[model samples]
Target: MQNVVIIGAGQGGLQAAMSLRQEGFEGAITLIGAEKGLPYQRPPLSKAYLKTGDADALSLRPASFFEKKQITLVDGTHVEAIDRAARRVMAGDRSFDYDHLILATGTRNLRPPIPGAEQALDLRTLDDALRLRNALDRPMRCAVIGGGFIGLEFAAVARALGHEVTLAEAAPRLMARAVSPETSERFLALHRDMGSDIHLGDPVCAVRADGITLKSGTEIQADLVLMAAGVVPNSELAASAGLAVDNGVVVDTRMLTEDPAISALGDCAVFPDPVTGRAVRLESVQAATDHARLIAKRLVKQVDDPYGAVPWFWSDQADCKLQIAGLAAEGDDTILRPDGAVFRFAGDRLSAVETVNDAKTHMQTRKRLAQGPVARAALEAAEFDMAQV
Candidate 1:
């Protein structure tokens, strides 16, 4: 391939460019991003960036790194359409030809159809974090929508900054989609202990100028409202180009789309789980960077190996850090350990492991799961200590 053009200069897109060079693919690499300036990390936008308000600290790489690597970065450019027939992408009047196209378009915040939803601020980008930091400058009443990682992380920081935080969740438990009920309850107590008003099973009916109203007719008066209601994949460009898109751009185990010339990665690509063979989409930095590296190897080194990297994720709330070693289905049976590590089982087979402030156990669980499915009886014999097994 002489030229590889990547869309969306976010974490995954930037990684594809870097990985291409690392794999010795000396092609014309162009990283196109809708946002201006350097590509920064999004995970910290909800964590340290809230407290420190340091924009420079969130940068993934310096401008010098891009220049030294001979990577072309086109910032503040929105991709209008993809011409599959021409093998080129049009950004307004400009068109760039590509030997291979990588769609790392990522995702955007999902704004619900609530009244005055636009009034609520977002925390998906550095610009949003900067706005949230400015809003948290004063001791304002902060009403947060959603009890997921972003909402809880923001609540912890807001409370630490001496702001009254009221977090509302439609689900019965916090992080219901990601974590087990036991782990969700644990975080609920942690947030409550930190002086946050945690409301479960209460969906925000409407977002007003001042605050939000719950479905149970309870209104939260606040000077600032944050929309942490999750995100939607950016797959419209790929869809317009006649690519199959379910929740995201549908890619195979090799991260290649139906068209051999195109591939998708990061939050915008939905591929089958290597363990389950079920369609799954991951939004972690690990998944994105790993997909980028694998794609780079296939393009540069002609490796035919499928993407089977073990999925893992982490969230920082207050002083507690919740980590998951593998991807657990929504209704997996969770077995709790004495030391507070939660093991999820799917039909007598280990699916995932959840731990709080336990890095050793987390790593061990990931290592074990990677070897293949562990029987429930074997785990019980080891007293649920993955390190021992």
Candidate 2:
């Protein structure tokens, strides 16, 4: 490959460019993004940025790094279309040709269709976080829509800032999609203890200038409303380009699309689970960076290795840090350890481990999961002690 063009200059896109250089590829690299400014980390936007307002600390690399790495950084440009025959992408009137293209389009916040929903704000981007921070400068009653990680994180921060927070979730429990009922209950309690009014099993049906109205006709009076319901993958561009798209841009285990010249990764790409072989799309920094490295190695070293990294995630809420090791399905069974760690099992095989403020156990569980599947029977025999197992 003589020229590599990476779209969406987020974590995955930036990593692809850097990995390509690290793998000794001297090709011309162009990293394009729709947002303006240097590529920054998104995970901190909800946690630390809301408090410190340190946009600089969130930057993955300095501006000088891009120049020294010989990577062309194109910000504030949205790729319009892809010409498969010409192997080039069009951005406005400009065009970029690529021997290889990496699509790291990422995702956009899902704004549910509700009456006056436009009045609600989002926390997906840096600009969005800045706006929310400014809104929090004064004492304001905040109502958060959604019980997912972003919503809970923001609620915790808002509560810490002495703002009255009211969170509404459609699900029966918080983080129902991502965590087990046991873990969800723990976080729900944590948030409640932090002085946030949380309402479960009730979703915000409407957003007015004053506040939000839940599905139960409960009107929350708040000056600021945050829409953290969820996010949809930004896959329209790939679908328009005739690339296969499922929940996200469909890619093989190798992270390559139907066309060998194009590869997709990060939140926008759905690939097979390395362990379960089921199609999965992850939204964590680990998956994005790992996928980028695999793609880069495949391009530079001509390796055809399948992506097999263990999936892990973390969310900081109030004083609690919840860490999950491995991926677990919705139907997976859970075994709660005596010390509060939750072990999820798919049939007899271990699927995931959840820990709060326990980095040692979290790292150990990740290493164990990476080695191979652990049997529930083994854990049972070992008395649910991971070390013994």
For 180-227, candidate 1 gives per-residue lDDT tens digits of 999998999999999999899999999998889999999999999999
Backbone clashes in candidate 1 total 0
TM-scores for every predicted model: 0.99, 0.99
Residue 165 in model 2: lDDT: 99
For 340-364, candidate 2 gives per-residue lDDT tens digits of 9999999999999999999988998
Q: Give the Cα error of residue 9 in candidate 1, in Å.
A: 0.8
lDDT value for model 2: 0.95
Task: Candidate 1: give the clashing pairs.
Answer: none
Best by lDDT: 2
